[model samples]
Target: MLDHLITHDDNLRMVPTDRNELAAAVGHLQEELRALPEGSDTARARVLTRWIGIAQLCLGHHDEARTSLRQSLELAVTIGNSRAVVATGLNLGDAHRYAGDVRGADALYRSALITARYHHPELMDFALQHTGKHLMECGDPAGARAHLQEALRLRIAKGDAELVKSTQAALERVELLISQADASATGHAVPGQWSRQWTAWLQSRITTRTPSRWAQDFPTVRYAVAGLTAHQRVHPCHLRDQSFPSALLTAMAEEAEKAVAADGYLHNGKWNAATLDAVSLFVGQVDLADVVSRSSGLAVEPPHTAVYIAYEEGQRLDFHLDEFGFGEANLILCLKHERPAELPRASTTVFLTADSYLECDLAAGDCIVFDGALTPHGRTPLSAGESVTLVCFGFRAREQDSRTVTHLPPVPSGRAALGRPESAPAPRCATLCGHAGN
Candidate 1:
């Protein structure tokens, strides 16, 4: 569909601007939105509205796109659509940029980025690219490079050829600027101390911690895993006491580490079966029930689990909570590249629980737990590679349901010594089944 749109969209793009093809598309989408039953899957309506925003943007209707995107974002939020929010945020920022408000555009881009960090690292590539472009436009090539590198990492994971090509083009521009800065006394394009400070502050707001008290007030958790069982070895440039994979975390970690070592980007980056397999591996590790409960303090029953994966640069899943059946427990896990940080905190994991919100700073090898039933969850855009995570749902079981429940191994004495409640934690041994990888 995207390919078709891209080729055919040129015709639409070529239409006379005065004739207003955007309004026609907007009208068609509005009709679609109106025809859907009130409260019928909002996802569809949101998606349609997103297309309308795209059309509006392509047709150079920045104001219309902004209006439509705002409405779309409101609907997404109403429907608990995180992906939609991210999409709308991106569109809104783009509208601002095209409308010649770079600062506003940057702010909106940053907001979208902050939202994306919580869901999937895959879409962060697109968000990063756009944000990087914005940063470059704002005279911060270093920040642009940082985001572009992340985007490139995700795209490499996804094997997205077009994105890699375009992103490389952008990177080349930044590289040239850096080179020029090095060669000329007054041409230093790298960010100054103040820009670095501001960027760091912005990152901390999104990746390191909850941006606002409101987010902290409503907490949710994301659960993800990889069935990595082998030890890989690596000398740590930062950690003095331990080398990576001197004890391996999992076989999967080898893939991740390899990608990271290669800087997590592909040369040609054409989306291929291998990239799909990587995404599958990522989702296979997702445990939605565990994510929801740990983050929101909610309980999930057994017998209902589901997972989905998105692989396109623009492909996205909207924000939503499973309110019916076994979907009560939900969470999202993002497989993203690790950033080099002195503190080892590279990612920000947001837990949206009922009446509470918590964003935890994370890095590779760290895990976050949260409840999904109490709060809604979804990813932004998958800009680079396919973002993978398991989405498991557990249903309340009846007394007559005679399923054998495998118990967790007894808590080690040392763990018990850490003051874990014996009876309270006993459920892990019997009630919640530990994963035996496929």
Candidate 2:
């Protein structure tokens, strides 16, 4: 499909697609501009040229985008369209950034901000959104957040739902980056569900990796562990036949599907789904954790959870270790999956042991409990039209080891730990989810 480069409220945005489509678009746009009669409206040509520049930018044709944007700006000035000038300037700044001229991008962003702030107050959000994105690209996510938050506030106040969403998405991207920065600083997982007071925690996102270059070239399945590994206490079980509350998992799966598909409950680049009904279910339901603890052979207290979903082609999780605390043990509930027809044995949660690899082809409401931090595990890639929604609960393997500890006063664990819902006839359940990561 041909990607659209649209201007809304004098701000530039693009629907991204492949380079061939964008290249075709630039060619078509150029032909259209050339077909305009001599002395035809410069304004029309200005818009076309700006679109061409954006298309080229998306195609990674930096010099071409910059040239087209500059030409568009000149036309805007010729037509005395100050709003277009400011808007086109933002694109030009992005071009400069792509061209590795950071100083030029910064200067243009500052100028655009000052002009919009004092002269065109209606365009404040446009200037701020563009500048915030530029700042984020320049390694200043905190600074970016302030600008994006204000832009979001303005867009919301203006009551344009689409504009509000666009800004909100941008803001959420920055928030994820900010969360990543915090994680890097602390040498821990991102703190969405994990508490700061806790010494250890697990996050639902995939691995944060520093790959050994040689290992990247090789393809070996078997791996060995020399350190403290997760001791196998409970066999990896697939609970069905209503033994694992399949009805509840089915209901929760519906809610989780909605959360991921409509609400956007993903981390990393895929973050900021609205926390809807399923989130409330996770926050309030204690029986869920109890079942996980019983099935996994770990006596865990109540646990907090985060979610994961993959929407793109070939999205996968590489093997890696998890942080302590929240990731010590985890129950990964497979809410949904869209396995591709072309790839058999793909897009499943696969874990590695010393001698062999274990692949869990999980369906909805089917969960696997394991030591996430200790096991080098990952989900394989998805093809086009493939997706997966997963919810993860983090807890400790032992009941007494589940307490949250820090410099402050020691506090008990979270709400309702390890309470079975009386579904199974047995008194003692299995272990907790030892594998902590998603």
Candidate 3:
């Protein structure tokens, strides 16, 4: 009869996110555990207790979560339920980490990661994600990125949007931390930047005179501090020193075309793929972003404002500075270029300098990294049947990211510029064309 009651209790294995719902569930489970005879059904009790512990963890009761999960973990080990043990270990590790026991958290996450790899590959991302977070918190940005990226790939393959989002958020937070650290190292660090916690870490790290294992243990942070130069604001750096992975670029171009076509853009403007959650999630990967940020000296956010930009016949841009929020540092990577004449040169010209109008013809895979806010640039009117497709990645200055939820930058008015025929109406864009009053 007692086994029957505990068996029925197994059906209450829901992990609710609501605080009130979680609290009620925790309380109910506790009551049930007290009612049960000691050692009546260890298996069922472990299952129930695991849920209770995780529920308490979600409820922000870290101490309680640790106690319950530790107890449940022992039961799982005793009963030989390795999977449950792995699962409970993850939550318990999170509890430890959150409660300021860094070493405890590190141990559990490492253990869980290894166990999940062999026993339950399905939960590998869960373990990997938490481990990555732990690594970042411990000041190892590169290791954190590597782990998070792998975890993201797995979560994406698993087709769980929520799980993917969780990993992505952690990855982004880690990326931002590296960028901020890079900025500080280059003597261009923004005073009082985003993330108080990250700022605090940097403050202590920068002043440490005694040679810590900085180069060996936290090489990513070290590289960000040593390998980069203060980024140039006026003259654009071609980044000829580094090679973008061709395979990734190929995949990105293919994905960009499909995404832009499906989500059509303004006739001669842009399609903001950053708004497309899935496409944005895939193309703007951590590998490309990390390189760009280190080279550019700006703490790049996930290219959430990334766009598919284009201009058709008769489209021209007057030289103008881009506004700050969306595009302070801009990466213009040409994806595709087509023209009626099979000219060996690029049909469209980018004026690197507005005063002198220095023209540069860019080809596919040629990326130009420049400060859009400080550099005056424009596109010349395209000849007949000429179209240029570009993928633009933009990041705001780190200190400038103090946007309130409602304080969004005004949308780039998708309007035709000065050269548009007066008879024709301004083309509306699925994205921001970025050429307005110029």
For model 3, the superposed segments whose C-alpha errors exceed 4 Å read 1-18, 187-438
Candidate 2: minimum summed lDDT over ten consecutive residues — where? Answer: 217-226
lDDT tens readout by residue for model 3, 1-438: 112122101111223445565576678888989888999999889977877777776566788889989999999999898998788898788788777899999999989987986678678888888888888878986567657766775665556797888777877687688668765454432212322232233333322121223222222222222111122332454543345556655666676666556644342233433223333444545444554567556555554245566666666554444534344467777766778776443344442221122345656666666666444455656667777767776654444432211122121222222123436332221211221112
RMSD of each: 21.3, 17.2, 16.3
Collision count for each candidate, in order: 49, 25, 0
Compose the digit string of candidate 2's lDDT tens values, residues 337-386: 76667765445666545433456776676677766645555655565677
Per-model TM against the reference: 0.42, 0.42, 0.41
lDDT: which is higher, 1 or 2? 2
Per-candidate Cα lDDT values, in order, are 0.45, 0.59, 0.57
Ranking by TM-score: 1, 2, 3
Summarize candidate 1's per-residue lDDT along 1-438 as a digit string, tens digits: 122233222211212244354556567777978899987867787787777776777677789877877777788899887877887888788778877898789888988887776574456777888888788767776567657755765665576688778777777777676556543543322322222332232233322122334333221111100000011010001111112232232444444444444443322221211122343344455433443343434444432322222123433333332222223223322223333344222223333322232334323333333223223333333334333322222333222221111121121222223232334211110111121111
Candidate 2 versus the native: TM-score? 0.42
Q: List the residue pairs that clash in candidate 3.
A: none
